[model samples]
Every structure is written in C-alpha cells, then in structure tokens.
Target chain A: MSADTPPRVPVLCFGASGLRFAVPVAAVAALDAAAPAAVSLAALLGLEPHAAATRTVTVTGGDRARALVVDAPLLLRVLDVGDVVPAPVALPRNPAVLGFARIDDELVQLLDTERLLAAS
Target chain B: MTDLRELVEAAGGERPAPTAAGAATTPCVGLRTGGRWFALEAATIGEVVALPPITRVPAAGSHVLGVAMLRSRLVPIVDLDRMLTGIATPRSERGRVAIVRAAALELGVVATETRGLLELPVADGAGAGDGTDDGAAGPEGASGASGASGGEREGVPWIAREVQHAAILYAVIDAPALVRAALGVAR
Candidate 1:
C-alpha cells in the first residue's frame, strides 16, 4: 500500500446556503437530513472552508457515532488522504474537534480518524 | 379528612421509611407552570446554552428545531412547547435551550424558557432519576400558531406571580414524556 494504491475519495457537502466542505472517506458518522441536520464533531469540522463561529452548527455526543446535524445542506464527494489529525489542545471533554490546516488555499479542521472509528 | 400521605400512599409503589412527624426534608428546584411545580431529577444534566438559531429540515417532522451543535454531536432540537403545550411556535427571541446527555444520547430542548433545576424530594414515580430530558418529540403543538404572538418569555414560569408581556403559560412539563410523545414512540 504505497504509491501503488490510489487515494480514497472524500465526499463534499453543499449546505443549502452554498457552503461546501470536503469530508474524509472514513470520518463520516452518518448523513442525516433530519431537520436541523445531525452531524458529528468529525463531520462538522471535517469539511472544507468555513468562517469560524459564523457557520451555525450543533454538536451532540452519540453512541457508536456522533451526528453532524445539518439543515437544508447538500453533500458532495472528494478524495481523502485519510490523514490522522490530532487536536492541538488536549480535550478534557468528549467530541473535542481538532485545530485547522490550509488546504487548497482554504483552512480546514483535520479530524482524528481513529477516534471517529472508535466512536462509530 | 384525607391524609395527604394516605393519598400518595394510596397511589404508591414503594414508600420510604417515614419519620414519626413526617417532617419534610429540604426542598428541590422545580419549574412551575399553571400554578403547579415540577422538579428535574438532578445527576443527569450535561450543559445549558441559550436557544440557538435553528435551520428547518424538510421532512424531518415538527418539534425538531433543526439541529444545533452541542459540544460536537448534531442532536436534533426538540421544542418543549410542542411537547407539553401542544403547539409549534416559530423560534423567537424568547426561548431557552437545555442540553442533556444520557445513555450515549445528547439532547437539546428549546424550553422557550428554562426553569432552574431543583433536586426535589424523591417521589416514588420519580423512578430512574435518569436525568434524561427525553426529546423524541411529543404532542404536536399548533405549528406557527404563535408566530404573531411574539411577546413570550423564556424558561418555565413557576412563579406565576411574575408573569410578563407576550405571556405564554409554562406547563409543569416532564422532559422525557414530551420527547417520547414527540418522537411518536409512546402515547
């Protein structure tokens, strides 16, 4: 599994308001359109560009997986390197998402893949 | 004369060891509405935040205030008014949200107003002090029926004597029952 293997495709989402994000091939908890779309910490921070705090999102702790609730937002697809990102500050609490990285000239929060799996 | 203890015992499953005088212990924090009071069983609360802006989800069903991010999970928001008051009012400036996590589930409730939490005398029916604010969506309140009625307050109004303008009565609500009912899980 080196240069011989192809990178996994990551999925992108287009929020109804036209917000787009690149999600990891693995960190997706579940895609639910349940009003007030439910999402996970990984899924919420796992996407593409967003202005800090301006993007209203609700985070909840769940069993096996935390839901990333979205409302009127659509989903897209992309490729994920499956990179494992650690949170800069140690979280004393659960669902603590990690800091950000610059991708394609846009800042994004790298999600911890292992933790997402353990929860899922 | 109906001894109140006899009335409670008459409808009892288990009774605590009674003191000879039946002196009441410390009072707990409970929300009052319609002249009645309710106590939220402690030991199960997670965190509390102001009611956040909720996006509507098509086909998600009423009572769901879209999803707000609590900590990190995307738990659906349940409008307590729809659960207890049987009405669906639009999200206005006056509302309270209480987020509680229990048994791997996190819940946020648009209480419209948050009556402070109180640890009350443990009643027999108060089984499971699970501290679970069940938010499955209960009784369907008249949706948007109160949109024009904006003069509302937040939190449960136990102190009816302190009523305010755009006043809506706060019912002594059971969080779990409202959720179950709204989710269509139970009657």
Candidate 2:
C-alpha cells in the first residue's frame, strides 16, 4: 500500500442501542469470556442502554484494561479500507470516535480504542 | 443478475459529441423558498436532507438561523427565506434542508420545497430582467402573494444572479459568494 493510504485493521463489529459501532480488534483482549467488568459503549456514546446487552468486549492497552458492554457480538471482520470516510470537520471534537466506515450498507462509527477505553 | 463481463462488453465505448457552442447547458438544483423558485448550481450541492433541529446561537448573524448536527457533523443552517425575504419562515413539516458546500465551509439552507434538478442554457440572451421583475424583488414579488419589497436588494449583488430557463425566471445562487457573505469574510 502507498504511504498515504491507511492500513486495513481488524475490527469487532457490533450494535449498541440500535446504532452500529466498531472497535479495533487489537484493543480487545477477550469477548464474552468474563463477567461484567468494563464500561458500556451505550453509556459512553450517550445512547439508551439495552437490557439485552450481554456481550463484553475486554479492551487492554499496556497495563490498563477495561471492558465495553454492548449488544451480542456480531462479527469480527477486516474492513475494506476504501469504504472508510474521514469524520467531517463539523463533528464535535470527541476522541471516542475517529471516523465512520460502511459495513453492510450501514455507516458504522469506528470507535477510537484508546479514547474509548479511557472513558471508563 | 447481469454478468459483469457481459455488461462491460455490451456497452460500446464511444464518447458522445459535445453540445454545440452557445448551446451548452448547466445543470442546477431547483428549490422553492418563500413560495418562489430558486436555482443553485448542482456541483455546489452536497445533499438534500430533512431540516433537523437547530440549536440557536446568541449574537449570531441574522441570516444564520443556527447550527444542526447533520451526519455527525454540525452544519450551520442558513435561513434562505429570512435572508432573502427579510421574514422568518414558519416552522413546518414540509421544510427541506439543502446542504451547500463552498470553499471549506459546508452549511445547510432551509428550503420550502426541493424541486429536483433542472438544466438551463448557459446564456439566456433574453436580457437581464425577464418575467415579472421579481428578480430584483426577491421571492415575495416572484410569488405575487405579498408586498415584501423592502427585502429586495436595491443593487444587484454578486451572489444572486437573475436567470431565465424554459420561460421561467429563477434566482441562480452563487454558492461560494453566498458562503463568504454569510460568514462575513472578505475573499
């Protein structure tokens, strides 16, 4: 790939409060393997927390670790680099979301792993 | 489903002849504002969406209604009716928002109705003022429903150009100039 083009990264696609969201696969240490320990994606994104949310995506960076509670895990897929579109300048400055990418005709907001984990 | 290879082969590769000189046409997105027809260059439009809730700002320009979150971006909503007709538009479910992009600024303009795309001759050659003189009177006179003459520009501005297409007169908006004026920035 050219230096300017972004590298294709693995992400765990999931839904939260009816809206689609994705997190980098690298940040996830485990999924649905442990009890509730991390923060909730809906809470961080200001969405209604669904009672049906059962999956936990455990995120770890260096010595820090946090779990993100979300709806049942859907798929772990490598996103097509071309489908990603950078966030517009008008969007509020929030580190939790980096940009958006299309997955199955749905525009899923890609979560910034580090920032999202820090929110807990 | 059509086979990709067959679809590509069936399409003959031939460049269509360009229109004759003086017959060139420019595509425009037609819209209705304050009960009158208006046109904007198709290239300047980003998308047409429902007018979302606007968060009003204090001490902002008169033309700037407020800003609204559009596709995760907070875009300024310019009240075209208020800007052109010197009257606040009544809130209604029929209102449409036209996302206009120029320079680095992307904003929305609340329109009464979106009339879809239109193709107009590059040059009408029918002289400047055609049909009812509403080109100078803004939307009020064009609609012929009210006498809001005070809102009309006494002098011709660079942003609004009077143009005629298919015997119908329209105020063709200059997107870039309009953006610059809305932001109060000299270019």
Candidate 3:
C-alpha cells in the first residue's frame, strides 16, 4: 500500500509431487491437456516422479519456453510481495526458486519462468 | 549417576587448556542424527521446535528437505541425517528442528533427538586425543564410541572437533562452515 511497496500480482498455483508451487500469470502462456513434450515438474525438482499429471502448462521466459506438467485443480491468486519470504540460505542454489509465498495457510514455492525454462 | 556438569567442570580444571581459537569449556547443545552424536555451539542455536509444515523447493539438493516458516521467517530445514550420511531419514524418525544461526544465515537442522545443553571441554589442539580423563560413566554414556580420533575427523570439514563427555564422543559442528556449505558459498 505504501508508495515504495510493489503491487500485488496474479499468480497460478498448482501441485506436483504433492508440493505446491506458483508462477507469475504473465509467464504462463497457455494451459492445455498433457502433451508429449511436457516435462514433469516433480522430476525437474528431483522429487519422486508423479505419473498423475493431467495438465500441461506452457510457460514462456524471454525467448525460451517450456511445458510444465502438473496435477489439476489449479488455483489462481493474487500474491502480495510482503507475504513472500526469501528461501533459506541453507538450501542448495536453485535458479528456479524466486522465493516462498504464504497463501491461505499454505507455503508455495514461487518460480522464475526464465530460470525454470533454463533449468529444464 | 555423576552429573554431566560436574564432569565438565572437573574436566575443564584437569585437562590442558585449549588455544585461543578453542574455548576451555564450550557450551553446546547435544544432538543425535543419523545414529551419530553431534553438537552445535549453544551460541549458534536459537531454539528447538517441532517440525513444521515444509514446502519443498524445486532443483534443491537432496540434503535440503525443504523450507519451513518458523517465527515468520522462512528457514531452510536441512536433514542432518541426509546431509551427513547419504540416507534419507524417515519422517517418523525426525524428532525436532534446532534453529541455528551462523553469521546472518539462519536455518533449521533436523535431529533425531536432542540431549539438552552440555558444557564440553575442547582439546588443546586440532589433533588432540579424546577427553576421557577419569573414564567416568553416566546414563547417556557409551551410546556412540566409534573410537574415532579426538579432534577433527578426516574429510569432515564442517566438524570443528570431537569432544568426549560421559564416554560419548560428540562431533562439534562448525556453524559458519555448515552455513557456508549449505548456501553453496565458497570457503
């Protein structure tokens, strides 16, 4: 609300490998049925692979693009910058992680579209 | 039934004093993880709390279990067992999270059990022998007597040194080094 504070932005939240994650709506180009080129978000995160991904989300960052496969029932929410917390320093350096946001009593890992694509 | 404090006080007075870098009697919180005994300097520890809901991060190393919000701050929870031994600790086996701070970095380390605060004597040098002066025994004694060297263990840079108390050897974890390693900061 302050003059210096950044405004809230819309984000798309989804689940993969039983973990919740979010990314800026601007980065999400399209949401479609599972495609052959879609990559498992769980596999990308080194978690146990989930075979139940029913949707593929096409994300774009700069000139690159990647399809992230995730579970259904996605939630769209507006994220306040103040609610975001920096990732703990003890975690391994991950370019994909922007930080963590507290949304409705749940902690969601925020992702950077460019970094996620690069990681993919 | 000798008290650990009495043993530490007696040991501090009897043993050769450590160098300036090492304290004569260092207060540490004893922890058991990966079936191995370890200690974190009391000054570096903030609090011990039950494991909170953790949100796993993408592309994080295997040692990093996830990040959890503790006291409004996101603290990365490192699985001590997985970090020290290449084995994942069962969720049921995790007992507590010891919130530790090193420099400006703060994180939580999972421990199978915490053995409370202990005043342990640091050896004179980096390669000094174990502090087994009186061969005294107690309740929490003899749980882990791997016969490893007294001071620093080989190949474990994060371990500042090894100290013995009540017949148990505890690897004193170097908080700064651990924080650096956890953040992937170069030494």
Candidate 4:
C-alpha cells in the first residue's frame, strides 16, 4: 500500500487474448453463447475485491450497470490498490492490456474489457 | 435418417413433434437479414420492446447503433444488421430493442425489428442458400457462414424474421459473438 496506489476492487479472471484480470462488475459485454441468444445473465460471484492483481476503473454507466470481462488471468504479483490511477485517457500501464489466461494449466491471451470499452 | 420430430416425440411424449433435427429447437427470436436467419436464443432475451429513443454513443463503432433505456436497465443497443451484413441497411419499419442476458451482465440491442419469438423446425436445411442481398453483403458471408447453419427456412430476405411484421433481412446473430465483441474477447 503506497501513497499513490489506487484502491483495489473484486475482480474475475477471463482468459482470452492473454492473462488479464478485471472487476466483474465493471465489465459489461459478453458472448451470447446459447441460441435464442438473449440471456438474463444473473450476477456472477463478483471478484474478491482485495487479492492479487485487483484493479478498478470508473466508467460512465450513464443509466446502466455493467461487469468487466478481461481476456486474461491476473498476474502473480499483487497490485497495491493505493497506486491505482483512473485516467480519462488510456491506461498507461499498471492495469494490464496485454496478458495471458490460465486455461487448463496453459496461458492464453486475456483481453482488457475496461480499456476496450473505454477506447471505443 | 431419424427426423427431429420423432426424437422430440420420443423424449417428451407430450412436447410438440420435433422437426428434422433430433433435439427440440430452443424458442428463439430469429432475426433474418440478407439470406440467412440468426436466432437469439430466447433464454438470452430480457425484454423485446419497440425501438424507442436511441441516443447516439459518441465515437461508437458501426456495430453499436446507440443506447436506450428499458425498464431502467439502461442497455447499450447494438445494430444486428450492420454487425452481420457488414453493409449498412435501412432500419426496420418497426425497429425494436432486445435486452440480452449474458453470463455476468446484461446488454441490449437495437434490432431492426423484433420478430415474435420463434420455435424453429430442427432442419436448418443444409446446403441451403444464404439468402444474401446486394454486392454490399460480402465479407460477412465467409466469416459468418459456417455459423449460420441450423436456422429454419422462412424467406429469402426475411430469412431471420424478428417478428411477423418485422420485414427483416439477413441472418440470425450468435449472441456470444455480440457479447465477445463487446467485451473485446473476440476480434
């Protein structure tokens, strides 16, 4: 915990482009896996706010609530919540955009949903 | 080959006879554009409302038409036609909003039209034509082809019917694709 680090929030691990971690509540979009694709997706057991790789990003929900789904697994090194900085522009580093996923003991690309949406 | 109706008749003796495919087709709201039918599994749909006011999400992509609020859900409505055909088409006469259910969160789409819920016949006629529109409807064909199978035949243009009066065109959307795209899970 440092003077500059931002606070940590609960996050879910999504394995996609690379190992990436994000808060489940902040990631809004997803895959319509089933047919008749409309789903009433219930809330997932949200991330454990304070653990390794916990990061938070504020977004303009505007009138909606969303969950963040990253494309990768979280890193081993824990991020000090105090050092986090939520910038209106793209995230410089700290929060991962390039990472890997732990799929059956293998690492895959996990996407950064927060940045993806923000970038768009 | 065993017909689908026979299989369903065997499983749930009381359920409607299955079509050609063995498993009972899930009740889906089929959105047909161009020549194919894209079914959004009914389970994923939250509320199907007529397209109200869609406020533009500045700098949003082509797939994203705009945003609309449904029952306080404040959903981000996507444009299925543009997302699929890759060619921009006129919005349906009865444009609609489809609130979708995902694994962790909910999303809404601005469907050109909301075809009433459908119980598709199993046989999505293999080797059937994709019912495409003009030269504009390219690129998406090869990419979205392998996935468009299993949609029951309805019409050439109105293949993916959103509703009876939807006057729709194009194929059914695989909800996962939309979700993945939103989450940046898929490229």
**Number of the top DockQ candidate:** 3
B154: Cα error in model 3, Å: 1.3
| Of 2 and 4, the candidate ranking higher by lDDT | 2
> What is the lDDT for B100 in model 4?
67
lDDT of 4 by residue, B51-145 (tens): 66653332346566544445433355665556555665356776556666554445666654445445543234312332312222123223343
Model 3, A2-118: lDDT tens per residue?
A: 898798999999888887889899999889845689888777777776656567888898789888888765889999877787766546646787778888788888888887787
**Model 2 lDDT at residue B129:** 49
Ten-residue segment with the worst summed lDDT in candidate 4 chain B?
Answer: B132-141
Error of 2 at A16 (Å): 1.4
* Per-model chain A TM: 0.37, 0.84, 0.87, 0.28
Q: Give the TM-score of candidate 4.
A: 0.40
lDDT tens readout by residue for model 2, B1-187: 2222233234421112123443444556666666555677666777788778764432246667756667655577787667666687666677888887776777788887776445544444422344323222133223433222323643525336555544455667778777766655567
True contacts kept of 4: 0.00
Better candidate number, 3 or 4, judged by lDDT: 3
The runs of at least 3 residues in candidate 4 whose Cα sits more than 4 Å from the true structure, single-residue gaps closed, are: A1-120, B1-17, B20-23, B32-37, B121-170
RMSD of each: 15.8, 10.5, 5.7, 18.2
Task: Return the interface RMSD of model 2.
Answer: 8.8
lDDT of 1: 0.38
Stretches of candidate 2 exceeding 4 Å from the true structure:
A1-6, A50-53, B1-97, B107-112, B115-187
Q: Residue pairs in steric clash, candidate 3? A: none
DockQ of each: 0.05, 0.05, 0.55, 0.02
Clashing pairs in 2: A38-A67
Report lDDT (CA) for all predictions: 0.38, 0.63, 0.72, 0.41
User: Which candidate has the top score in TM-score?
Assistant: 3
Top lDDT model: 3
